[model samples]
Target: MADLFVAGGIVTALEDAAVAVGRLDAALAGNPLRRAWTFWSELDAARRHAGADGRKVDLFRLAAHLHGLPLRLGDTASAPERGREIAGLNYAIELRSWMAAPDREQQRLRDIALDSLRDCGGGQPALVATAQGMLEWLAGQGSRPAIRAAVPLYLRDRGITIHRLAAVTGGDSLRAGPVDPDGFTVRFLETVGREAAEGRDLLLTMEREWRQARLRVDHRAGARSNSRLPAAVDLLAASPLLSISALAEALGCSVEGASRMLEALVQLEVAAEVTGRTGRGARRLYGLKRLLPIRAETTAVQRRARGGPRGRPKRVLIAPFAELADDAGVADATPDAEPAEPTRLTAASFDFDALDRLIAAADERTRGVRRLLDRIARGDKPFPTADGTEEPGAA
Candidate 1:
């Protein structure tokens, strides 16, 4: 009876896994951001597996590093440690790539797996034999860690390349445990179902966000026919990050125009600048606010404290003087419109709260300076003069 119940559970699990895989595959079909989605999914898998091995890899930094962006000061990982982690992540990503390779390459990999299994005196089923052989080959390469890490990759690859299921990693289920083929198969199928469902949900959320962003952009520019806005939205969705120049090139527009469009999206709350810095020459990056998990490296308050303006300073204009009426009615008689709102000075604007904080911070240093001066006055220490010589009356 126990054996029969286990068999029933396996059947149920397999059905659920098939349903989830179908849903995920449907979502990926014709997805405009499919490449971006796959890249993020692979990165997420790498993150999870790295975490299992007691390493915390920041997804945002890894993405930025992969894209050749400059790392912020907060990324304090030592060079060797960062390199090792990145190499592992690259290998994990490569495994996914291999799983998605062309039919010929996949055939080659399958042949290798089968040959290894035959050499190991295979009597298991085909799928189980292939997986065991893959592990055995990895072990022969002296990669115990890879043997463990590759379990999910091998299962995902088998599903994608052989079973025509969605590419879904099983890391969430393949925890450390005694090796039991039946138990492992149950867990692996269960994880595939769960991960496929999650991937489908994520894709749905991204699509929803994309549509909402487009609607917001259209609503903000009512009746103006801003054709580039939707394109911008699509571009932002497909790329992890974009700079003004990149956007301009993509949209076939001027840099200033692209900047203006980005600001408009930001104003409409559709997009967000992920880069924390706004100083001159700072590399600014922007992305869809809802789709991306990355936030600005610094917040608005933090940027203000750092004396970096959030954007270009507002231009101040000098009000023109009222012209004196000419004797012969030569002055224009058109009525002037209501005076426009005054443009505030960006550079000279004062923040009294920040000023107070600065003064408070300086108090300790001020007291220390005063104590040193008092000690010099009492000859407890020699006082240096402006000429870098000790005062004559000092000790």
Candidate 2:
């Protein structure tokens, strides 16, 4: 019975994979990345729910990272300025939504979509679409020939090389030459709706190359950081407007150490040399901003964060297992028995007034800090957050 259960699970998994692959193949064929924020939006949702199942899958996470590629690579904002950049982009997305929604009823969904966009800030959609494209390839649906017909169109629009496309997109890997016996050729052809084998070879050629290209892109994006840069770089890059002195204070580091890192950044071109001067002093300070063609840095980080194409995202993936189990019971003679501990996935929902109070306190503290900064910018002399008493600034 246990063996049968496991076997049933295997069959179900294969079916799911095939379904996912078909969806991806359709996406690639149509270049659904053209769907105006659809790719990033879905990728964002997938990322949130990828680990909702418990076991991690690399494809979903990769999809999430890939969704942010456009803004990351193309935007002029510093990495730290990502929030502001994202805020601006989100406003634009909302504005577009507001303009495009045809009916008042659809407007609510559009608003929800806009809110989601605001929450995620900005990211790469191409990479996300590619990752998803690969997953859908595995699901083995409809006809492979139809899917094949779509591939060229898909690859052409996305600028996806065949090699890279195959590698990172997940599936049983393939090689060049006469099709291997245990290969995906016939299955792929069948899935895409191609009856003749002439296009079969050509489609396989494209598929193999696309996989290789994706592999190379994924590899280059995930190179190790040789330098000992702080993890704060990632956090700060996400919040770019922070001043060096402010960052030093936040990180509890000496001002000079922070300056040295900034110097390194200037050299690497991750940040441009900006001239910041004290009104009363000649001391020039340094800050970092993301380099142009922001795609390069953002793509790499997205790839890394998704744990490549093989590993899963860090979040939870919630497959509808309960629904599946009940359905499975009807399909098989052996009724699905409950596990020893119940293996509960859904947590009990409850209110937390105390937690709300704590959150309120934190909000108050943030407001206080903002007020203090405002005061400092004014002629108010004394600096707060200092030891002993507030020290007056130089006249």
TM-score of each: 0.57, 0.21
Off by over 4 Å in 1: 1-9, 68-167, 172-174, 291-293, 296-395
Clashes of each: 0, 70
Off by more than 4 A, model 2: 1-90, 93-228, 232-246, 254-257, 269-290, 293-395
| Lowest summed lDDT window (length 10), candidate 2 | 341-350
**Residues 123-188, model 2: lDDT tens digits:** 423323322343344253322222222332343344533211221121112212234322343233
Reference-based TM-score, model 1: 0.57
Tens-digit lDDT track of model 1 for 259-348 = 888878876878877654566455567888742334432322223324556753222232111122223543444455422222221222
Say which candidate scores most in lDDT: 1
